[model samples]
Target: MKQTIRLEQFERADIRSALAKMNRGIERESLRITSEGQLATTMHPAALGATLTHPLITTDYAEALMEFITPVSTSITTTLAQLRDVHRFTYQHIGDEYLWPLSMPCYLNATSDIRLAQFGKSHVGRMKTVYRQGLTHRYGAVMQTISGVHFNWSVSDELWPLLAAEEGRENNADYRSERYFGLIRNFKRWAWVIPYLFGASPVLCKSFLKHSSADLDFHELSSGMVYVPHSTSLRMSDLGYTNKEQAALKITYNSLDDYVDGLRRAVFTRSEQFADIGVQTGDKWQQLNANILQIENEFYSPIRPKRVADSGETPTQALERGGIQYIEVRALDVNPFSEVGITAEQMRFLDLFLLFCLFTESPELSIECQQATEKNVNKVVLRGREPGLTLMDEAGEYSVQERLAHLFAEMAKIADVLEAESSAYHRALQSFAPAISNPDATFSAKLLRMYEEASKIFQHVGMRFAVEYRDRLKNSGYEFYTEADFQKMAAQSLAEQAEIEAQDKGSFGDFLAAYFEQALDKKKRA
Candidate 1:
């Protein structure tokens, strides 16, 4: 039977007090490419501090790709303001290099042209680089270049204790962790709504399809852009980060222990396909190992249970020590229209949506339900706004509009508990209603129309957005971090990086062996 949750479970007076203290953080990733629309060949800017040690600014898979992280804040407005300050500060440092405004890359000549992010001579630093080497060997560098935003969210500590009291349970990490897992399961079931509303990458440069034998029915425009009509986010589809090897792993999220066990096994178990590639060709190291995953972070998912790791503690170890501190939402595309790639309205809606996931009574997800969820997500990513589209529930198939309307209605109840001014959340739902009724109002459809009107020149549109965003940031002074604050952070990060490099006394080979053994030992102890 489908689980049902009553609104009366959260009486307004009690829930309203808790809602006012929730925390949120955002991590946005963007590729830094040159002015003429070529991938940046330059090293990460020295002015930006060490990528390995910097708290706010860091490099992702490629040296050219930059990721900006905001410190956790209770106010949604404050988090976004901090993100904008990071952007403004970064713009001052990256001379002539434009942050790619869209989720997809602008242009690429070859895979070799993209450089894996490099770190200095620390054992940990080397491991980070070697892991990227594994990723490039496992998946092409072009796929790694695709960028997106990650939203990290959590309720206040007081709120958790209140929830535990209401449930007549112990206010401990175990209870909180289990509840967070329930939220994760519900997110998996309903997260299709995210991509349907915010998906922005409906098209790609033809260069991305150069080497692969992907059988996408791409329609080519006169100016050389390829797209699948009615597609919402090609970035989330098979053409982007989807891998058959990882898919075969069947990672489950029914509980914290089950999820962690699946991830642990995948990391340790060697893959024949990767083994054939070999870990080393003579003296040079090829990858961390021939395992399905080099580390826990490599197990990509739409959402993850997160805990702030202690000094020298692994991600899994942190979770083992203290249950989940927050959940990271990874499904959002970089909204091309916004200067900072995300807006206050989007964040507000996300807050409501995540709360809905938490409040809803989530049933234990069976393997069949898991597969159904995947199907629904795939349908939304590819053709969400197609006229009269439908998604499957355990009961049967239903129209997407009907499903969304029901979801919005539930979300409104959450909004009331949040004590939010109804406009932001209400307007978001109302605006999305049109996309359900008419496809052209969707981000993908509007983007495609822009491309058509611009004579099919994708680069032109992308470049225009890039320049406009750059100027916007350049003109706006820092709202959160000051110039002195950035300078201090950069210097501190450099010192930390140097100290780490100096502290390393073991060979890379020995370090790798110990890392794997330690993780295995932890799992056994648990």
Candidate 2:
């Protein structure tokens, strides 16, 4: 049963070359704010490009919430440089608005102030906006406005053959998908370390709680700031992305089929709660449908298996045609200390952790174990920096400090092999090793301390970083992409969006029916 490969398995040339050439991409979201530190009421800047067809820049839930995407590359420094260039280019077009630095948002009065992201007149573009409308009706706009960074990672194809041989399985596409699922299972079991080491949202503005119905005990601070003591990231807590409705779905990751089938079922399954909201009122559509999910992406998780879908193809359809291509890590908070919301060291650490996950023993995750894993993450999100905190594991309860040390020791072994090509892997591990024993040295702890020293005014500390980063990026200029390159891309995106609109030939109802029909057809084939 222990046929899993060891850290010492990198002996062959193919394996060694594969280990050195893993690819990574980044997607970071930040809200546009005014000089007074209020949410920008303006529409998405036209100079950036159409939100629907843009390759590099787009909008998230709100019109003011900008999402920047970096193309995939093997080098971590290049990935970071692309992100920085995106920020620098955006600053030039945004006029007076500053990109909000913290994961938590600025002041807000009500949901109406937060406009849904607008796409062009094309059917597909309209569907994207309608999805956001569904989210606002279902989860409220405030919660959806919280931002974070997503890391998309995949190992080399050559490494997969080595893994398939070690497991005594055929070197096929399905085996690759299954092994990626195994990595995901292990990632869930040990993901708490991420928020502990890189979390930056220790406090939030009181405006975030204006529409909240949940009863949470929080200490109030001056200037409408409120927080839980010693919390690492309230953004990852129940207050943020943790949704009760999706939690009830219990999507399993035992295999690729299990994962895909669960998402498809959830999309088709009706929900009484959503039914009450109603799908449409006359010509205006309020939401997509009265289902547990509007689409596959509605079923939220800390991580997801992803494939780049072709035009008119659903995410599940793409996965069915081709096995999982990569895994997107969605647990990271935007690091306020960095101009780009993430550092090269953080990316290197993630690479080591993911490599460790691939090589570690990953058992099938049961329902009870899944719940326990979630509880572990929740504890870390709320009280990770608290002294003597313990978490539940398969082997009874264990102190977080002890578990982190053991995990890091294991990661160091993988880093040892990886550093043969570049010392960046080992250097990144050493950078974060101190946070294991000394909780005060962690990012969350430092953010909390600075917030308190600023007289408990959340924005006092956040706005400072926002202003500083804005000026630095504006003056630093571009790192990778030139101004002409950005302008051409933006113009081309707008032209592509216009062509899509011009090519429309069907009614809105017909378009909706066809889309749903395709989804149902894929499920039937599965």
Candidate 3:
């Protein structure tokens, strides 16, 4: 039923060098809130450069929803340092606005207040905006405003050959892609562990649920605060990032080809629900198209196989050209306790856990198994701290604690291998053991406990953390970038946006048509 790689079979030098050299990057998202804790109505900060071309700072679904990206790095400490530099630089320009510390947005009086992120007049820029509009027409803007952290990572290139040789397979692109897919499948099987450990959004502002009748059992602390008593991340729950429509697509990870085809089909497939809204309503481009997804980016999942797409190349196209170059983990909630939303230890833990995913036995997921995985994730998202809660696996039902114990036991060997580079790997792995026996020791449980003891409303607590982090980031010096460096990057991004606008040709309609005309076949046509 499974095939696990024995750590003893690999040479210690190979283990030490390969695992130590893995690449990591972070995309941290935060909503800009006023000093009064209301969402900011300002456009993207000019000093942060064009959202379309900025290398580090940009906006997400809403202009106020700021996203800071770090360059790839081989060291966890260096990656965190880069992220810190970005945050400090951003704080310098945001003027009085605070980066909301939590994953969920601050209270919003109306959905109309959430503005779609804007780019310049270029065809590519317009397409980006139109696609977001499509999301709004499909799902509400409030849903898009909820922010989280994305961890982009890739195993060392050297490690793949070692793994290939161990498995008696050729060390080629196909082999690499196949192994990465195996990692993805295994990641899916144990994905619930992520939210259970790092989730911080147990309580939500009462206004978040004002417009809809979501079927959830929430305890109201006051008129302003509502939460699930034993919940971990409400952000990952049905009330937050979960999508009912996308669930029907059933994208599988049996192979790179199947995964690519599934994404392409979702992009091309028409949706009657989206069609009812119409693509163009009264000259305003309501959406890009009436497809189930405007592009591959719209298919939300806990994790994704990724590649750095060249200009004019779609995600699927890039995968077809070179297979998966990396993976992006999307399940982490922004840790409110940390100034930069994540810690170096958290990064180390992720590296160890992902390696465990790669080396473990991953079975092909049938549709039934996929649904079971979803159920397992949902259970953890809603009631992760519930005592004695059981979850489904290939080997029938098991206690969540039992499953975690097994996972950590397997990961200990990876930590040992990685310890050759730094003892911190083992330390990070060992840090979560306390949470296994005591749910209150977990981040979500601690966050909720802190909130309850503070005797303040949920939004008030969030605002306090926002202000605290803002002040700290403003005062703390940059870790990796200087003020001059950020200034030059901003100027360069502005120039790039202008050049892109100047080089544009044809109407946006023609550009959109040509974009959709790209073939989904294996090789690109000349």
| TM-score of every model versus the real structure | 0.96, 0.96, 0.97
Lowest summed lDDT window (length 10), candidate 3: 517-526
Query: Which ranges of candidate 1 are over 4 A from the true structure?
Result: 1-5, 420-423, 456-459, 523-526
Error of 2 at 73 (Å): 0.5
Give a tens-digit lDDT track for model 3, residues 363-392. 799878988988998999898999999898
lDDT of 3 at 352: 79
List the candidate 2 regions with Cα displacement exceeding 4 Å: 1-5, 166-168, 420-422, 456-459, 523-526
Distance from true position, residue 279, model 2, in Å?
Answer: 0.7
- When 1 and 3 are scored with lDDT, the better candidate is 3
lDDT of 2 at 496: 95
Candidate 3 to native Cα RMSD, angstroms: 1.9
Error of 2 at 364 (Å): 0.5
lDDT of each: 0.84, 0.86, 0.85
Error of 1 at 67 (Å): 0.4
